[model samples]
Target: MNIKLIHSKVNAVLKAASPITLPVDIESIAKKRGLDVLPYELGPDVSGLLAIKDGKGTIGYNSTETRVRRRFTIAHELGHYELHKEKSDLFVDKQFIYRSQNSPITVDHQIMEHEANYFASCILMPTDQVRKELEKMDIDLVSEEGIKHLAKVFEVSTTAMSLRIDKLGFF
Candidate 1:
């Protein structure tokens, strides 16, 4: 399917259901989705997974990741379900690199990654709300603690939160 089709379909889903925003809690979503969430030690092969068989959703992750990283991974996997699950029942995310938006990468990979990241950020911290929050703070307040708090509010990692903030032009 075309990217536009995928974007429209994803947006429709979000419109039909209230998207998760403030206090973005993945555990809550997992519980709501009837998923069994578990943690595994981080390693070279550490990644996130979601399987649906027999009418159940199961999500697994590397416990070694920081809370933020874990949240992003979970969110990314969730994106696959929301946007591409009918095509494949499973997804494995291996790397969690922090890259610039301009990084040279495959077009398709970059686009999907961008969308997943966008989905994660929007689900955790809707752009409108984040912009409003930024309006009340100084421009230079994107500190580690501040980012962490925003991530907590949005249920994402500091890295993801920072990227979102930057993308939203609040930085």
Candidate 2:
């Protein structure tokens, strides 16, 4: 997948979505894109899913997950709606795709997962915003407490913050 292209697409979506706030109003952005966001008591293995029916799209997140994880799940499903709609009308974002040997289809599925995750990270923890936030911090991001503080500010999990930092080349 072309990572740069995904970034560009997400930027455009953000522009159209407008007034992006911290922790992001993902539901509002999805609504602006003509998609509905919903909460569901999904099975343990499933985090989120995207469904398109009658020419309308809906994203559903597992309500049982922590707030941050649920947000990520929603964004992940939104990523599928934005980038993989042509690939499938429905996407089940489950825990894992069992490994398969030398399967092109498996590779494609993995690529899609990566793309969706990147999309979610970019939207939620935008590089510019992250930099701006970091500039205002006096704490060292290398420490667990520091990372957790930043995550709290972004309303994301510490794990998500760390991954985004690594992706942004901030380390």
For each candidate in the order shown, give its overall lDDT on alpha carbons.
0.65, 0.85
lDDT score of model 2?
Answer: 0.85
RMSD of each: 4.5, 2.3
Candidate 2, residue 13: lDDT: 86
Kindly give the number of clashing pairs for every candidate.
1, 0
Per-residue alpha-carbon lDDT of candidate 1 for residues 1-171, written as tens digits (9 for 90 to 100): 244554564455445446645666765665555667778675856567777777566778888877777877776666666665665566556564325456555676566666665666666666667876666665355677778777666666677788878866777
Find the candidate with the highest lDDT and give its number.
Answer: 2
Q: Give the 10-residue window scoring lowest on summed lDDT in candidate 1.
A: 96-105
Best by TM-score: 2
